[model samples]
Target chain A: MTARTGVAGFLGRVTAMIVKEYIQLTRDRVTFATMIMIPLLQLVLFGYAINTTPRHLPTAVFSHENSDVSRAILAALRNTAFFSFVREAQSVEEAEHLVRAGEVLFFVEIPAGFERSLRRGDRPQILVAADATDPVGTGNALAALSGVVASALVRERFVGAIAEEAQGREATSQDAFEIVQHRRYNPAGTSQLNIVPGLLGTILTMTMLIFTALSVTREIERGTMESLLAMPIHPVEIMLGKIVPYVMVGILQAVLILGAGIILFAVPVEGSVAVLSAATLLFITANLSIGYTFSTLAQNQLQAVQMSFMFFLPSILLSGFMFPFSGMPQWAQWIGEGLPLTHYLRMVRGILLKGSGLSDLVRDGAALFGLMLLAMGIAVARFRQTLD
Target chain B: MSERAAAPAGTGERSAADVAIAVEGLSKRFGANLVVDDLTMTVRRGQIYGFLGPNGSGKTTTIRMLCGLLTPDAGRGTCLGMDILTQGREIRAHVGYMTQRFSLYQDLSVKENLEFVARLYGVPKPEAAAQAALERLGLKGRGRQLAGELSGGWKQRLALGACILPGPDLLLLDEPTAGVDPQARREFWAQIHALAAEGLTVLVSTHYMDEAERCHEIAYIAYGRLLAQGTVANVIAASGLHTYTVDVKGEGPREASQRITDLSQKLSAALGVDMVAPFGTSLHISGRDAAALEAAIAPFRGEPHLVWRKDEPTLEDVFIDLMRGKDARR
Candidate 1:
């Protein structure tokens, strides 16, 4: 046989390496099933389980006046569905204590002469203070307060005006009341908009990390790496060969998640598919490279899997997939900036929810590219060419 | 096969074009353990070189160094006319190494494994090459079977087939027939000999003396040191040991084994009796000084139940003696 040379030989060797990995992956039934099942299972589980617009928040109300106006206002507050009046506070201090003790998420206070002042057209105010530690839980509820209170007072005045006309007395205007919404935290609230795209990054990071993380170490543990090293393949070629198959798997997972998000949860994609695909491909490669790095660094398959999880924990927690990205402290945001998932989360959310284009996602895309390069570099450098 | 003349041992003066592997002072250390001591050996092209050693004696390490699977901690060498240190990749491309353990992708089918090797070597028409290898291995019908499911002998056969699928210049087989049955081992040696006859060099390691006798050249290393390097006859002749076989007549297999053990212990303590080992119903007593050995065994020759006959020392006798000699020093 003549010596193998030139581009054809390289391609042949790389293709063989890739084809071998594909065959092994297909043969491992449990692993193959897991690759497809994880994304679908997570999408179904997290998609419906997470809700930002929370309801039935426990609340306590303290009213000094035992009048019809205070009763009607309290009833109206209950109708908003955001507050369930679980406790009736006897004093203002007790109401605040209930909110602080976490038994109630909201507290309401009405002054003693509020009804009389409103009847005299003096514009007396009613106070509503809310526990706002979780901004998303209280944002929309507080925004809906002013509208509900004014309409309830208007209805009350209309009924009173009809009675006064029959009794020969004049009814004053119903615009004599003011509602002070003292609730703090995010006023805009959150929507399903952030969740679906976050799921895409999260699910991709999890499965993609484990997939390539086990590739090299599994070969080592099985004793096949000795023969592999004896072959005519470069380390970079082997890394790419191992990663290429999982990149395809990653794409499949991304498609499964995004497709499910759009179809099942009505999560919109406001950006171009091309940009999303490009960004998704970069993010997937970045994750696969990290997994491959772990594979090369670990001594055995178990250690490889452990290393992958070690990296996965930080990627999931700090990437803002679980928490609000901007709401985190400075140190966490700095850490988040270094993770591929963090940038991918931003890119995906920007594309799907914010209608971000290529220019709008340049920084995030560049971060993803840089992360991919860094991981690939480390993996190739750590890859052992000889058994020694 | 006709007997061929033996090459002079350790000279390694063969020209560059004819020598496939010629290394000098190849040493390796694994942390505190010196796995392969300063060792020098050569393999002429188209000749089968056999390695003999006990477990952990550095046979595998030497083979790895030769094939570029390991770098010597302190040494320089050349394989296939390329520098072993700098040209590892080039040497690796030309060497087919079968490890002591079964190292193929077990989940892959036999044919897929072969095709993977073939493609990696850039063999034209990998499918045809793999098919031909399967046929040659007599595994054509089992081409689709998972490699892990194959029996030991068949796995060894398929491993050899995969190694040769790439048509490497030198095949470094580390104890290729370790657990194989005698019949399969004979067939494997036949294949190795056939490959050698076709001008392909083979370096194989094994424990069986019969297998070592079949090689054109052999090296015996114990404790990371080369104790013997020559042909079978040359190594035995160089040892200068005088041997005698004593058969102890007995009532049954158990009693005969007992008598042989008793005689071996008695003779082991006697003066000039360097080695006394039991093989089946006979005891082989050998010593380096021939006259002392003869006198030492003369008293036993006249015993009623024992019959003695002079014999040439076998390779196992020579190796055990070498191991004992080394053990005595440590």
Candidate 2:
């Protein structure tokens, strides 16, 4: 009987504890709402917004002759559900520039006299240069290239032997033409080349954001902010004091990650080191400003951390860190454009893999600058000077 | 109004420079609840003002308003001759506010916390200032220790040391000795008196009655209103309560205690008896009218084994009467 009563007593104490916790949980309305909303948001975002096998990738064509066979090949490539012919370059130089600038993923070039040579069965070659920096984005689209072009020529009756054979003539060899494939930037299509630079952006965003997000809220929770605010100092001075130290830490963190990326993963910096440093500095400051803004908005340390995670989830998911940028629907891409990591990822990859200069990445750099100013503005405007 | 009107002569009329804090008609509200309502008082230079009230009775709110930590929703005030609303930053520069809770950074050492405050207020030679403060507060040996690692008494001392590091002319302390030991509290008061002798005005809030008696002047507040404000003697005299002490004898010690409890209950329900309280082995009964009190106690005074003597009412009795009277009016 004593043992049974002891067990019942334990159960009774546990019941009281559970009831107390439930009441506390409900009293904190922000935490309660976040608990229910985060999971639902994740479900909706992952299910509808993400796509792995991306389609309608931008492509450019530079055909030497306006022949029936070239038109047929272009139409055939469009019908394959993998390519979107967004631009038709007037010259090979223009097509190469389009691919290099990342405006188009693939450039198709047909040499002069290719149609006459094919008619005489000389077996001429056409060139298809693919921007292979993100292999996942261009892999399947490049794979369907030769088959679609060959079938389209036969189907269009542009192949001389195939057309003649339709009138009961003897058939000849069916080798219509040749295709020359050139993979630019990363010729070997190594995944490490793509992932390492992306990891640099992802790591910086997570750490810089969380560091500053907890800075002010921790002071507030510990009651130190009360004494600090009671002093004769401006709010902007306090904000700058909190942010400047973390910027130094952020710089050290960037160096550590980039050093590890190069020494361990063999990822080469193909562009000017000055340009990379400038962009990294800008990106770090932008993330820190955004995190400080969250700190001002949150009521306490726990809420500040939750707000950081809420921001980080979208950054990692929609910033093309895990998936191809072109794979998501249009609206999701627009949302990605507003995130700093999305633009940073482009600049880092453009600098590291493709050796893009500052002029080529100016637009992305400006976007990061604009985001930093906006977050800083909100943080300053939301700062409270009194205990009202 | 009665307390102010009955203030001891020669202290009320002062020039602007003689006043450390002077405010009229101050009020503050949070959401739907009014925390401080139409309160007004003045503190002269070099005076140790004691702020007394129950918990959540706006003691801290009043102190915060004085130091410009909080803006009064409706009123005008001045701290050290600077306007509370228009010149908050200037007022804060001359005032040091030690919050009720320990507000120094726990992760920092004692010296570091002091130096941080010194630098914040732009004190020259911050390192030397922090060292001198440590020596003065008797915390020279604990300079390297974290503030959070100290006991309650030591933390309170360190908080005070940090507040005075900047050498402000005025100090506002909100219950600095709430959880401290008796010995520490006495020492803390001695330090306050020493500072007052040096011409620094201090406004400290506390719940201890003995501490209230130590103040040069005191203010009693309840329900967001200042019920009384004056010298301690003046407040007690203005209460106008006639008190008597009664000692009841019974068969044994337990019986005597029981007799006193029963007598207290009976006297509480009698006419003209406004307050009945037990202190030690004696019972105290107080009333507003002396004649009515004498008639009500005539029957109890003649009872067997009961001795009654007229006595002066204590500060405790007067404060209890003030609190009860406020409640009855509400």
* Best model number under TM-score: 1
Fnat (0 to 1) per candidate: 0.83, 0.47
Tell me the deviation in Å of residue B118 in model 1. Answer: 1.3
| Residue-wise C-alpha lDDT for candidate 2, range B121-240, written one tens digit per residue | 666666898899999999999999978899999999999998888788999999999999999999999999899889999999999999998888899988789998888888899999
User: DockQ for the candidate 1 complex?
Assistant: 0.65
TM-score of 1: 0.90
Residue range A1-388, candidate 2, lDDT tens digits: 0111243433432332233223333445774464344333433343335433367889998988998778888898888777888999999889999999999999888888877876776667778899999876777567557656665777887775843443222123232211121125653445556767777787778777876898778878889888987877666666666666556666766676676657755789999999999999999999989999999999998998899999999899999988778778999899999999999999999999889999999999999999999999999899877788
Q: Which docking band does candidate 1 fall into?
A: medium
- Which digits, one per residue and each the tens of the lDDT, describe model 1 over residues B1-330? 324336845673778888888888999999999999999888889888889999999999999888788989988888889999898888888888999999998999999999999998899899999999999989999999999999999999999999998888889999999999999999999999899889898999999998988998889999999999888889899999999998877558888887888888889999999998888999889999999998898777787778889999999999999999999998
Any idea what lDDT model 1 has? 0.85
- TM-score for the A-chain in each candidate structure: 0.79, 0.57
iRMSD of prediction 1? 1.3
RMSD in angstroms between candidate 1 and the native structure over all alpha carbons: 6.3
